[model samples]
Target: MTQTNRVSICHVAVGDLWAGAEVQLKVLLSKLVLRPDLNLSVILFNGGRLSEEIERLGIPVSVFPEDEWGSGKMLFELVRKFQRSDMKIIHTHKYKDTILAAPAAKLCGIPYVVRTVHGLREPFEGLEAFKMSLYESIERTVHRLCVNSIIGVSSQIERRYMAEGAVPRVVCIRNGIDLEKKPIQADRWLTRKELGVDAETCLIGTIGRLTPVKGLSYLLQAVPILLRQRANVRLLIVGDGVIRKDLEAQARDLGIGENVVFLGHREDTLELMQALDIFVLPSLSEGIPMALLEAMAASRAVVASRVGGIPEIVDDGVEGILVEPMDVTRLAESCLRLIDSPETAMKMGEQARKKVVQEFSATAMADRVAGLYKELVTSR
Candidate 1:
């Protein structure tokens, strides 16, 4: 059956704000669209920034601005689009998209449906947690019945999915970052000065949505200890969220307010990464964070919690130190170790950069996905 035709694929993603999963989807499109034998397009729910961003790249896009999600009309419309377009595979991201698109793909008679679990939302406490549990139950049921395969961004996530029996196949693909080949920007020095930090200050930073799952509270607790040891040390807390005020109050109470700068929701993330002396990730949970990958690619010494797929990238003492999650004392000790031993930190950073170059990259991830698509299509 060697029919000469391009296999069409739809990327179904429902996102309100652009973040990790959205960024990762963009990266995949940037590479996947280059395949001559495949036709790549994206399905954006609630058209706004994500839809506009993808369209700007010249990728085919279908924006559902008025479609009420999870409604019968929405599913019927999606199934019609798939059937009319003659799509072969449907790749979905996030819970809502997965739950909705799975049945749509099946109803449209699409040969295969695969999902990429970027990472589950950080389960909030109380009713929020219960809501997440109910959502997971629904998502799991759909995955087991409709989806053909599941791709996890980290081994930890893969294991979790397998344990839950979410799908027949769960694969670990690990999150990757696309490092620009350009030289480190010259404005890094100016960036530090603009942040109101001295030239000699050891700038430690982390970037992500300000959420409890990020374990930023622990980072704030460690700030006073870090300052006590090295008065010239400064912590740059990038991004903003519901906990921004609480985090600020904690920093002030710890008496390290001046030493910790709250840089709210920065768009110049790469430039900030280039300026950092050390990259710290004290997340209580994650699925191989792209921020950590980008920092490593920038050749900054990393100090991350030994949780999720972080260990798969950081390599303990080789590339960076891995401390227990929420262990403020150990987190502080890891940062101070890098600050004190500048030479060692430099060496570790160099190793981390080499690892990123050799393995974790957007191009590498795209290639793997293209191969998977070919494999699934061939089996059909």
Candidate 2:
């Protein structure tokens, strides 16, 4: 593509930490960056792990000082930066960055301001709630006027954002992963041996930050009942968090310590995922969980909570099982149901692999995003 034809785009990250949304951004970039028609760059308001990781991946990263966090000077600097960058679209993520960056994108006379809705969460409460409601009313009007389009990672998120009536145009673009779940079986013995689990043990695991929102406590609570039903059932909780010690203690208190393993954060997430008989995500809330997508891609039967954008992928009795969020007994029952029927679980896993290949591919996701950028650019 020639200079005049290439579309320059910038992605303004929502937070410093590299979580699910950030991971999706990286995956999307890996695909989009390779296309000849697009130019990609990521901006970090306060440089953190994400900036470093993306930099390591050979992507251009612009890191600004953290000192300008909540000051008007930050917007001034952003406007100046946007004016100088010559980018056609300024894509912002998360609420804090959206409220700040979208206005700057508009003020700088950028052609498009795209906001990706990971989830439209309440960033305020109580007396702050009253102030936020007033602020939201004004901001929603500003959004309708300034923001060109909004990208929702799932259909559920699109509906939620449209209901809020914030952005004038909203589009649903599901998240995708680079590594697909192939038919080739992973080295189960190697992973089990590394984790010191027997071959006969039924492995169930989840990958996510150890936060209250993840709903891991409910999984620990259900472990005792799961153990009583089948002592061979083993649960592995991956990823690190502040609640690790508390969760470990909870497991011990429940007398299922021996049955549960906290694997912390593992680099071989796909390998770990491939080794599991069942993948579980009991998040109380979510927006098209990357882990669930990875789980489905890994060709493992899933037992995720039927919340947020999960049901969009995991059809009940199709790809995997769905249990209500925070329902420990029901969660346990679902696990036991899968364990009792390995053939059924394997079938669900196969179906999940097909669904991911059919609809949720990194290539398809990148194409959709690229098409959106070209259409919006040309229309202007």
Candidate 3:
């Protein structure tokens, strides 16, 4: 598409923080804003951290206040906003955003309405699960009726939704990172001192929101086992969420409180990744975790659950070790193995770094997305 003919994209998001979807949105917008062919605008459900960041990128942000309308009125407001802005494309992230904005896109006569699925629906059990399933069914119907295309961060997520007959026009686009960004400098000694970690300790760290799906409880279970064998081992958790207090209590109850540090949400995650001996992600589910990619990019040997798009990235006994989700014994064993065999771990880290550089660069991902946008706009 030429500069004048390029579509105007209105990216809508409901969240207020830079989580996985938010990070991906930021990366896409930052790149798109610099493209002369495209005009970009961002719409947030409520303005906070993310809106501020979006504005900093020189993209105009429109915020919808919580009390501006009744529960059902927001959709009409969004539709009016899109119409007034004359957006050519409406790209949304998160289920709530897609659900609310899809009809808006249609009503505004937007040519393309794209929704990116960040992860599969969380497994639900019992009455709550039944209710969730019903809601998901309705959302699926809305997606089919209103959205032009669906993008999944992983093939697994795409297949899952496809099996449900929810998304017929689904595509997989693995999340990417900037490999040319400054590498995480190895400052193990200084980081240990600053975090009060013992210089001689073997540290196992995990980074993600403190949510049940993250399966941080499983990591907590593994800590006692590792401490039983190697008393000098420590666990460092980064990121904060609803379950932070609960996880802290779990560590205390498990009697590994002293060895576990809940460093809630650090901006210097890359630097912290460098100071760790091993990076672990024990999530019950995931969709190509950006943290794991950053770990691999930082050359940290990883021990992650063998679920979601993890296997696609970490080859067992090669790039990194993958254990079954919530398998505390195996998770601990993987950590111990890496700690005991420094040579193998270093080799694995090197391989992981090379894999990320060659396969998951930000430029490659952006180019693919740009191509898709062009294809869609031109086809119209």
Candidate 4:
């Protein structure tokens, strides 16, 4: 395609947090920016690691810090930008972006407006629940009224909207990572030594925010069970969040503080994965977590909860063990089974890596998304 015929698209999102959505967005933008047939840009609500990383990808990034601007001001600026640019489609990530960008794109007469539902709405309680419900309702109304397509990062997420009788606009586009990126070559022994664990230790690790939705407390609850069976096991919790102190308290309260290490947030996630004998994701809900894919990419055997889009990626006993969410006994049993049979865990790790290479590469995801852009633009 020539420059004149290339489709111009803009992605909008709350990029303040470097979580799964931001990681996926950065990966997608990195890949899409390489396509000559597409012109891509992004609008972020805040500037942080995500904005910095995407800017380095040579993509144009516009930041409208929420602290500095009101919602109406953001929407007005989005409308003006959409009207002035050759941008043919506006794609949004979070609810805030969707509520603002969808209507702005429509008001600007942009032909296509797309939103990717990253995951199910997290569960909340009392006043927070009421606020979340209102926000989600408005988000849904905007999608229904203004958006042209709704993309779900997992098949389960797509099925959910379809089951709810959401318009036939829902589509599934599973998240992927850059499989060809220079592989981490950190020596496992060296990395493990840095973590203060010996060769005899079974280092099981999990990477994600320390939030209730992640169900990390259950993982802590299961540590004692593993400890009784094997004295050489240690649990590593990577990533930090609002509930960090609470989870640390829970671990200490369980009297397994000596065996559990909360590493907080770190930049060397892939390198850290190299040190783990097993990778675990015990989230109560998820949408094909990027960390899980990264772990599999590192060839670490996984023991993850069977929830949301997790089952879509991990086949029971194939790629990894899948236990019911919040089932501490089952969680411990699954981890122990792998600990007892190193060969089985190794085989699963190999299979998991193969699955990621075959089905979930960032290049493949970008191609699929670019195809959708072309289709939407041409149809218009």
Order the numbered candidates by TM-score, best leading.
4, 3, 1, 2
lDDT of 2 by residue, 282-331 (tens): 98888888888888877889999888888898899999999899999999
Q: Once superposed on the true structure, which residue ranges of model 4 sit more than 4 Å away at CA?
A: 166-168
Residues 95-175, candidate 3: write the lDDT tens digits: 778888988888778888888888877766899899988888778878888887788888898787667665546787888
**Candidates in descending lDDT order:** 4, 1, 3, 2
State every prediction's TM-score relative to the real structure.
Answer: 0.95, 0.92, 0.95, 0.98
Please give the CA lDDT of all the candidate structures. Answer: 0.86, 0.84, 0.85, 0.91
How many residue pairs of model 4 clash at the backbone?
A: 0
- Candidate 4 deviation (Cα RMSD): 1.1
Instruction: Report the C-alpha lDDT of model 1 over 1-380, residue by residue, as the tens digit.
Output: 12258888899988567778888888788777777888878887778778888888788888764356445667877888888877899999888788888899998789899999987667588998899989988887898889988899988888888898867778888767776446556588898888887788999999999988899999999988888888899889999998999999998898888888898988899999988999999998888788998889989999999887888998899999999999999999999999999998999999999999888988889888888788888984
Q: Which candidate number maximizes lDDT?
A: 4
State the TM-score for model 4: 0.98
Worst 10 residues of 3 by lDDT: 64-73
Model 4, 1-380: lDDT tens digits are 88888888899998989999999999999899988988888899999999999999998999988879889899989988888998888999988999999999999888889888999988799999999999978877887789888889998889887776545478899999999788978999999999999999999999988889999989999999999999999999999999999988998899998999999999999889989999989898899799999999988999999998998888999999999999999999999999999999999999999999999999999898888887787774
lDDT of 2: 0.84
Q: What ranges in model 1 sit over 4 Å off?
A: 1-4, 66-70, 180-184
Which residue pairs collide in model 2, if any? 239-264
